[model samples]
Target: MLLGRLRDPYINYRHRRLFHVLRVSIALTVTFAVVHLFPLEHSSWALVSTVMVMGNLPHIGGVLDKGRQRLLGTLVGAGIGLLLISLPIPGRGVQIGALVAIAIATWLVFSSRQAYAGLMFAISLLLVIGNGAPDFSVALWRSADVLIGTLIGIAATLVILPHKATDVLRFMLADNLDRLARLYHAHTSATSAPGVDTRELLKATSALLVKQRGLVDAVHREGRLSRGEVDELISYQRRMLSTIELLLESHWTTREGHDRINAMQGLRDQQHSLARDLGTLAFQVRTGQPISTDISPFELHSFAELAVGARGTDGRMLFSPSGYLWLNRELARVAASTAQRLASLERLPSKRLRRRAGRHGLHEAQRLDSKEGSQNDPGSH
Candidate 1:
């Protein structure tokens, strides 16, 4: 009963949120325990470091990446801090000049890609110089605390219901492919309204493209996916998006003669066949199953012949089919290529599959529940 209740979508979302809070809390607690046991000076810094490093769930990769950056920054800052403290210019004016110079340099660094390191450098400089005399030991201790806290954050992420980047990437890829299938169905369906808003599909694809970049970065940080695999996934997604855009353009350009295309038995049959094939491939991807369909080349030659021979009531070409055949052929080719890539991906061994299986099981249970609900409804019957 507890498991069933946890599987409820609202309950699951709350649990996920709570899980993240627990992970951070545990990390902070551990950091504090160590600091108190060792009687470390400036222990508050360690707590701050842990809080900064512990990100939300399903982003272990991001947490580790930030931790690495924090360590690197701390080291660079400590070095700079020590050097500034050791300067031999004994006058107050010289000290002020050094401070001004360090501030300007740190500001420049903060604007660069190594902004974290730059900020750390500035902070360390201030901490070291805040004392009446320059103390190199202070800089060292601060860096050590930051490193320790970072390690603690990383440990918390790995120990707590660890979320792997690979699984998240797989889920996102499957969801995006399914969205593409829906867009394709809408575009190709004979019954779809001519004035249907296609921009929504384009907007969704564009958002997915942006998300793909972030996921790729996360995977790279986690060091789970090889360079080749990353390249292939990114390339495949781009091609799919391009094909979707082409299909949308074709639909819009041919809107004036949409009735004629729908009326033609061959074109209608081919369109439906292509849409079904796409949907099947999408399902295979979402379920991590090997794709087995051999999509026959869209009968482009026949389509061209019919398009050229057809005439309207005014005895003119029914539509400007200039790139219509090419677009259809390209969509089929891209879909086939995407399916082949997904099939290859599915054959790879995944360590996160067991964890993902639980999520998939919940999805199945929810589906069953919805089916039962509908069956029990008098309106549905």
Candidate 2:
């Protein structure tokens, strides 16, 4: 079971690592080919530039972002270079001052979200100053060569065995949801404290937030996603997480904590219901389609209610009519929900459909009766 849980991370790391190795190797090969096939006036400079740009491939998105920044910086720096060189600077000191001013301007302008743009600006500034701003023709040619190298670098970074941010987002959704389910079960079972792992959960939740946010930003940068399905998937994840937070806060409240065990009697049933919905949702996300089947909405709503109702009550009163049965039902719902989602992701048959054979009915009935009014309501019945 533990090994299964680690599967996603293991696969993701392997794929990314492989991609890094392959992409870097290919980029280096391309650089060698470029140096041998098309010799430049400064072949060493060309090779150095190629390596600098291609070296960034392992950090795809970051390299692209930096390139954009560098472009912006370069444009501003070039303009500043033109003005500084055009000025009536009589001595070598004044010329040096002008170059410094242009470089600083480029740095400042390119510093925005795109670091690469700043780099471009600085490089352009230095090149132009060193060449004494030779006819615009010469400066433009050097800039063009640099741009070509930058393009090759960016292309290498984005293309080789590229992984999508959406994949990470989906993985996180499943991982965190599974953890939340386990935590909820533990809290209700008295196997764990109400406040335990709240910090960890919060941290995981924040990480999800960051990934989701980045995914959206990425899609926007693409101008549009393939369709609305991805957006809908993101929205569903947000809703699922909101519901999870609600359940956690309800469970933690002192007022609800004591009575919570009982009020959450229906939790199991609710979990079952939640599992179905979560499964359907995850399927839609994975396949990039809308949910074709309807999910039982009441299960999640009821579980949420039960969680809230169980708050801040006395532990002894946990077996009362309003406590035990309600909580048990809620727990069943939660368990079912968890199981369903997990099954969907793993492509496994759900536990709900598996029936145990040849159990003694009388013994089961007796056990159920004995536990009917008990606080520690296990869901075996």
Candidate 3:
């Protein structure tokens, strides 16, 4: 009941924002107190480092990543700063040139996955060596303060209103599958408006898939999902989306060819059936459970054939019935492949959301409860 209550308000955008605001406020307050408590010069760096770690990423994975980059950058920059201070440079110009070179090298790596690390490295270097006095003790203090602030940020993120990436990813993936199912039904429905603009919808779905890339490591660490399993799931899902896009085409054939294509049997019903399977897959993904029965592929009969070499006597490749048939088969193969890949996942029990919370996920709870009852029944025992 407590979990249910927490989730209800957490689902609200305003409430989520409030949670983050409170998190940052609490973390900063503690850091401020500590800064005043210490008898060190340049203590303001602590507060700055805390905000740097906590400002953008509210999710656990993102915070962990930012915290790691900040710590690494601070340590490396401080070490280099100490080394540079000891070097017998000819003049201030040489020192300045060396700093510039370091800055340029760091900025060049900003386009890679370690982009944040590069920025943090540059900032750390500047903090350590940029002050008028290049004192070794001052550099050590700045590095120490930065580390302290980063640790505080990480602690606050973990203890106060933490949003684990695994949990977020589960919600995201389930929602994606459900949304795709809705799109499938809408696009394939007989009542769909003519010339409907589905481009935006497709673009949005693809964008969500891209967002999943960051959370991949979270699942690996928290859910123990194998890299290959994650790749297959993502790859097949992409294939499914691409297949749907290809299915939206103007027939490259003559009137007779178009008629033959339209005459294909059971395409509409088959679409609806496939959408249902997609919905089921969404449920399974949310709960981290396998379906009792396997999701079967579309029957070959549904793939209606067109006449061989559909061209008007001019030898133009009008409507390649074979190509049309091949696409349908590809769609079926992809859909089936997606289900099979999902089923193949070696999901750890710990990965399952056992909480009977939230209206959107009640089915998983109810089903699990029923299964538990069966397991404990006296007659069964």
What would the TM-score be for candidate 3 when compared with the true structure?
Answer: 0.78
Candidate 2 on 299-344: residue-level lDDT in tens? 3344455544442334442223243334434444443454344334
Worst 10 residues of 3 by lDDT: 348-357
- After superposition, the stretches of candidate 1 with alpha carbons farther than 4 Å from their true spots are 1-16, 56-58, 87-89, 92-115, 193-205, 226-235, 242-256, 288-296, 313-319, 344-381
* Candidate 3 segments exceeding 4 Å error: 1-16, 87-90, 93-110, 131-134, 193-200, 214-232, 251-255, 291-293, 301-322, 347-352, 357-381
lDDT of 3 at 129: 69
lDDT for model 1, please.
0.64
For model 1, where is the 10-residue window of minimal lDDT?
5-14
**True-vs-predicted CA distance for residue 97, candidate 1, Å:** 9.4
Best by lDDT: 3
Q: Scored by CA lDDT, what does every candidate get?
A: 0.64, 0.49, 0.66
TM-score against truth, every candidate? 0.75, 0.57, 0.78
User: Could you tell me the lDDT of residue 299 within candidate 2?
Assistant: 38
Candidate 2 TM-score, true structure as reference: 0.57
- Top candidate on TM-score is 3
lDDT of 3 at 180: 70
